[model samples]
Target chain A: MKLLRNLFVIIFLFAVFVPFGNAEEKRVRWKLAMTWGPTLHPFVDTVENMADMVETMSGGNFVIRIDASNIHKSPFGVFDMVKLGQYEMGHTASYYWKGKDMSFLPLTTMPFGMTTPEQYAWFYYGGGMELMQKAYEKNGMLSFPGGNTGNQMGGWFRKEINSLDDLKGLKMRIPGFAGQVLAKLGVTVTNIPPGELYTSLERGTIDALEWVGPGMDINMGFHKIAPYYYTGWHEPATELQFLVNKKAYDKLPEKYKEILKVAMKTAAYDMYIQNYHMSANAWSTMKEKYPNIKVKTFPDEVLNAMKTSYNELLSKYKKENALFKEIMESKEAYLKKARDWTYISDYLYLKSMSDTE
Target chain B: MKLLRNLFVIIFLFAVFVPFGNAEEKRVRWKLAMTWGPTLHPFVDTVENMADMVETMSGGNFVIRIDASNIHKSPFGVFDMVKLGQYEMGHTASYYWKGKDMSFLPLTTMPFGMTTPEQYAWFYYGGGMELMQKAYEKNGMLSFPGGNTGNQMGGWFRKEINSLDDLKGLKMRIPGFAGQVLAKLGVTVTNIPPGELYTSLERGTIDALEWVGPGMDINMGFHKIAPYYYTGWHEPATELQFLVNKKAYDKLPEKYKEILKVAMKTAAYDMYIQNYHMSANAWSTMKEKYPNIKVKTFPDEVLNAMKTSYNELLSKYKKENALFKEIMESKEAYLKKARDWTYISDYLYLKSMSDTE
Candidate 1:
């Protein structure tokens, strides 16, 4: 009888310990959807880097398979799909969903908004993250900064814009809130599909166009055709977004969760650096090989007009939505203080060096 | 007989799986020594953040204990301690080790170096990491950027500096390579203990002093005594470093290695943002409470002289050390290209906005 009792106790211990051990070794598979196609540099690279970190950090026990727009067949559907748990997570820009929710527009960027470092400060250290959570809470999704493209170029123009008269009646391939602001300035703003942008600009179907900065823009061959590459105005610091279904996120193990969060954060910052490198290299190549690609800033008259239109549009949105109002006010207040430090620090430093030159 | 055979098989399986599971579950404890004291905000917070991320990502299997300067009793001894494996890691500035090796100087920041974003691009993307690893390989240690204080304030001054003559025979409490450059320009440079800096400046023993920016300088209460706050010229992007014992790092489990790297990267970026937030808040507080503080830039004549002095010192070091020459040339070339982008992007944006204001 004692021998039998000992056998039973041993069996119970084995049953208890064996499953616990297996749990640690269990393999978890997740799927991610990205708004960009697989061919996009830095953007696609950011998603891949995050998954790589997650896999290596989790020892292959947790894996995330990414589906780009080519596979997913719906770039704009990412937020809804993640919300519905169709995919565990997504990489896309928040402003892309403005058609569904107008308040989601400014999360990506704002005209004359905070610069990259300033926006990052606001996101992580200021109340930007909390406000973002609040914005997405009702949608059953979680959002984080996926990556940044730094300051995007204003656009490619066949002719230089030296006055407000030069902007009026201009047909430009620009999109989103910036498009609206441009349209208000009498620009015949039209959205051309990405593949058609270069052809349209070349063929004069669109007189001007705005893509990303030189890093992503070099391939479009726009610099060869349009010599006037203006500095950015509409989007100062365009940050991409990472969307995760709250239910999917909640189901993750604590270790996996931390790994995912850290991986995402690091990957976001990495993309910014990577793009900086690409832009620098591309700019160097362009400057040496294509000397005609003139870099210009919109004259003060045109810029001030654009700013006025931007403010008016922002005011309209603020009046319509309380949350939008709150978010904008927060950004304005933070920018006022942060920009002062920026002016006294980086701005002055650059100014001093340039002055000497 | 059959039941006994089955029990033997089960016992063998348990032996194999249990050890494997335990290996993954094994707890790793590491000790880190920081150059800053426990009270240093954002700097100390950066170390804690990295450790916290490591713990959570490894599910408490990897833990790091941080010892501040107060506990370690040796602020400058961190590099040696980590090298000797007395501590597995350290948080300090790279320039602190210039006494041991002059090549270690520019890794922190040059007299007029890249800004935070520009320096980060050089570090992560533009071959800086490879060069750093090569430099530190002889010491059996690895280093990474721990945090950034962004552009430090040039210094606080009791009187304005309007010309090259203003700097002549001026006693200033400044340290490191910047002080070396300043001393060359006929300024009487002195290094005072941090606790006595305020008193020294108040008693006219020091005419000017450079500490960290508004984020850290607020605590020292220097603004009350020194009315002239000059913008940064030296140490544009002062990056603190994390030093790790290589053999100890190599021995870590693959999972822990990824966790540690990702944690360090995230924490480093976080510190930059956190400091940005702190500086913004502190500057606002200072401006509101202390209306007498005047922000100034050194006159063009003085700046030009300083630049000349800086170039001479750098050239002297470059001729002495091949690696230092290689690193500085690399920085100069990269900065030339990157600064063009910066001028067109953030600089123009700020210039336009300020013009309107």
Candidate 2:
């Protein structure tokens, strides 16, 4: 009778605790590749923040190992690595994969597209995530917004661009769709590695170049060579992306999955805020030190021509690809309404403040 | 011998799994109070989202139940409820407790302050959070940005103000610091419950009233009666807040603490984006139904007088409270640099786009 009782006690304890305990502590280890080097501000910080949140939330049961481009030795290969499960995840921009699929281009940002908050509203609430998923589903990956650079400066120019003719035969380093648009306006567009960009511009090999905004640009010393800083037109609200292997993501325990998702979402927003701070501080310092640097906008004639070129290119894409058309239409419809709100809310408020000052 | 073996196996299993499993599954239940009623989205939505994320991320072991103002019967009592630990947390705006403590006012926002993205940058990356904590620490609580309403509209006015003289003796229903500013400018500022606002405006009891922007205002049908919607000068980025009892927060398990923090952060940002979407859609609908509604900015003379009045009120607060002075200085310094960036980035971008269109 005693032996039977002991057996019953042991069985009950095992049934009650062991399986549930093991499940809760189930370990998940993932490796993430990045398109950027390790030292990149805000970008690398975002990945680390996401990983740290996951580890802490999961009680150290889940860990993500991050590999920057130095270790991966393939900056642009992040998409393939994540898709093929060579890495469980990756941090990169969707626009870099435009050559692989035309639908992937607008997933980042377009020339004269919606600003950061407007784009975020579109992404999360205005049927953007669904369209984004459709773009990545064929690649066997899940993509999420990683971080946002609020706006990219049009570029650094040696001289102000006053008219469309000023762009004619101007040697510049601008990439992606904007490069194609500028090419139509007779600007000589070339792609130069970021490391050589400074020397290229200084040596008159290039007249101007579009890098990121002041936050990322100050460090590159672009302002030293190009005195005229044009405000953003191309790549407004450049959102970086996180790509996860669908199968690997599917394999996560439900709790860890939720943790990863929440962490990623928080990290992405944090990066936007972080970069905003960085840009403000950096621009302040840059302005104090380089008061001679000029801020210019492309004149109406040039701006109008660029807009026409953008519309033409967009029309071509809409005709060429159905998914591209679907995504563009969604964005255009959302942009119309969202921009109106933006105008009445923040824009008017800002304009009034400026006017009063 | 068999009995001994069974006992040994049971003992080993108990030693290995029971303690660990029990720790992982330890149930924690908490309650949160909110200043809003059940239907006041995205405020209520923010709370629900946080609770849902907490429940999911903690694997259902930790749960937070939310009680809206209707349940608690104390919308303004949330600060005290959270401070005294009647609830583990509360969702409310910081400025609601201005009568209790002057320092709590600037934590929410200021007249002519930073916009949403700019304020978010200050809160997360700049010194706003630390100062916010300093303000709450004395009350035995911790405060976090709960959500943002972006930029708010000034008010719905029956007639336009052409100059500072036009504002004199204007009967308006505008609350808080903004009301004080207007009152100083010789306006008759009154406070009325939200339910009676439309009727009061219609009955000529008040010539103007400020509610939230189009998102929260469309339901009130104010535009139908007051066709002149003024642009915002006050409460540019009205951030809601989450208050946690220090003791309750300290008592949480480390993993649960991380889960709660991450969940709150994500939910706050999500609410901001959600509201952006809501306002966009709402504004579109409002415009379609009421084509006669016009957006207007106050005349320079009127705006300049309001700014002078705002500065005077702020200076008085600074004299009365050291903490208020400290927070205001920090915000002022941050706003100076951040607004500069905003001008070059989103402001300039929006301006150029509008100009071109």
Candidate 3:
């Protein structure tokens, strides 16, 4: 009887404790590829912040290591790598995949679409996440908002753009859809590597380039060369995306999954605020250091022409792709309601203050 | 020798597994009190969302139960309850505790202050959090951003306030420091419960009342009675706060602590976006249903007077409290930087689009 009692105790301990041991000992190590290079502030910071949060929350049981474009050697190839499970996850913008899937174009931002708060509202509560998931799931990947750059600057220009004529034959490095929009306006639009951009602008290989805003643009030394810094019109509220392989994500334990999701979200929001802070600091620095740098808005003629070109490009995509049309319509419908609120809320409030000040 | 080996196995098992069992089985249950009632949409939702995330992220081991004002019977007592450790946490606005500490007034919102994004940037990246911690730590509690109401509307008014004369002798229900500002302008400022607001406005007991913007005010039925909905100046970004007992927070395990903090952050941001969505939806509904509801901004004379009154009130607070003066100076400096970025980025972008559209 004594022997039997000891045996029963052994069985109970083994049954209860073995699973706990397994849970504790199991470690998840994930590699993430990034579109940006290692030195990109706020952008690189977002990925690192998410990874750090995951490690801390999961008590180092789940770790995500990030590889920038320099290490990966293919910045634009992140989506494909994540899709094929070459990297478990990737940090890039959804709009980068427009050539592969037209529906992905407006996921990042539209020319005159919703602002940051409105876009977030649309994503979380206004059926955007469903559409985003539907678009990504077909590629065997899940996508999430990685971060927001708030509103991007229009670009750094060597000369002020006064009219549509001023844009004619101008060599500018503007990427993706915005490039296409400017392309229709008789401008020479080119895409260059980030490292070569400063030299390209300085040597007059490119007369203008639109990188991110002051937070990011300050490090590139663009302000020294391009005195005419135009305000944003192309990618207002540019949101970066995190793409994860569906199989890899599905395999995570429930606790780890929740931790990863929450971390990514918190990191995304944090990046937006951080970028805002950085931009404020950078702008203040620029003003103090480069007093001659002029901030200008495009003339009415140029802005109107760009708008027409944007609408034309959008229409062509809408006719060519059903999902593109569906997504644009969803965004357009939401933007209408959301913008009305924005106008009444933030817009008017800011205007009132500005007028008084 | 065989008996000794069996005894050794039992000891090893006990050493490894007993602590694991205790860690897995020990559940921490906490109660949170809220100043708002259970039915408040995004406010209540923020608490529920935080609790839900905590439960999920902790794998049901850490749970938070929320008590609304109806149950807690102490809308204004949340600060004391959290400080005394009577509740593990409390969800309320920091401005509610202004009587206890003058510095708490500006933490929520100030007249003609930063908007949502600007305020959040200030809070997270511009040393607002450090200042907030300094204020709350003295009370034996920790405070975090609970949610933001976006840009609140000025008020629902029955008559147009074209000048200072129109505002004078006006019976209004604008609460907090804003009410004091209006009181200085000869307005009869009254405090009415949320339930009595519509009735009070309808019967001519109050001529104007500032509630939360369209999102929250929709359910209050204020728009039907008051045709003139004015844009906000006071309480431009009304941020709610979550208060945690310092001792209770210190006792949490590392993983649980991280989970709670992240969950709170995510919930706070989510609520802002959710409220934005709600406001957009409600505004659309209100416009369609109540076409007569005119969106107005106070004239320059009234706005200028209100601004002067607000500055005077702030000057008094600054003279009385050194911490209040310090916090106000910090906010003012950050706002100067952040608003410059805001004007160049979102403001310019929105203006450009509005002009073209």
Candidate number achieving the greatest lDDT relative to the actual structure = 2
lDDT of 2 at A161: 92
Candidate 1: clashing pairs of residues: none
Stretches of candidate 1 exceeding 4 Å from the true structure? A1-23, B2-13
Question: For candidate 1, lDDT tens digit of each residue in A216-289?
Answer: 99888999999999988888999999999999888788888888998999999989888888898888888899
Steric clash pairs (candidate 3): none
Residues B1-357, model 1: lDDT tens digits: 557656755775665566656657778999999999999998999999999999998888899999999999999999999999999999999999988888788889887789888889999988888888877889999999998899998989999998888889999999989999999999999999999999999999999999999999999999999999999999999999999999999998888888898899889988989999999999999999999999998888888889999999988999999888988888999899888888888898888878876
Question: Tens digit of lDDT per residue, candidate 2, span A84-108?
Answer: 9999999999999989988999989
Q: Between candidates 2 and 3, which one is better according to lDDT?
A: 2
Question: Which of the two candidates, 1 or 3, achieves a greater DockQ against the reference?
Answer: 1
Candidate 2 segments whose C-alpha is farther than 4 A from its true place: A2-21, B1-21
TM-score of chain A of each: 0.96, 0.97, 0.94
Provide interface RMSD per model, one decimal: 2.4, 2.5, 2.5
Report the error of model 3 at residue A287, Å: 1.1
State chain A's TM-score for model 3: 0.94
Q: Which lDDT tens digits does candidate 3 get at residues A19-122? A: 65665434899999999889888999999999988987776779999999989999999999999999999999999899899999889998878888899999
lDDT at position A2, candidate 1: 57
Per-candidate RMSD vs. true structure? Answer: 1.9, 1.9, 1.9
Q: Over the stretch B247-329, how does candidate 3's per-residue lDDT look in tens digits? A: 99998878778888999999999988999999999999999999999999888788889899989998999999999999999
Which runs of model 3 end up more than 4 angstroms from their true locations?
A1-17, A20-26, B2-6, B12-17, B21-26
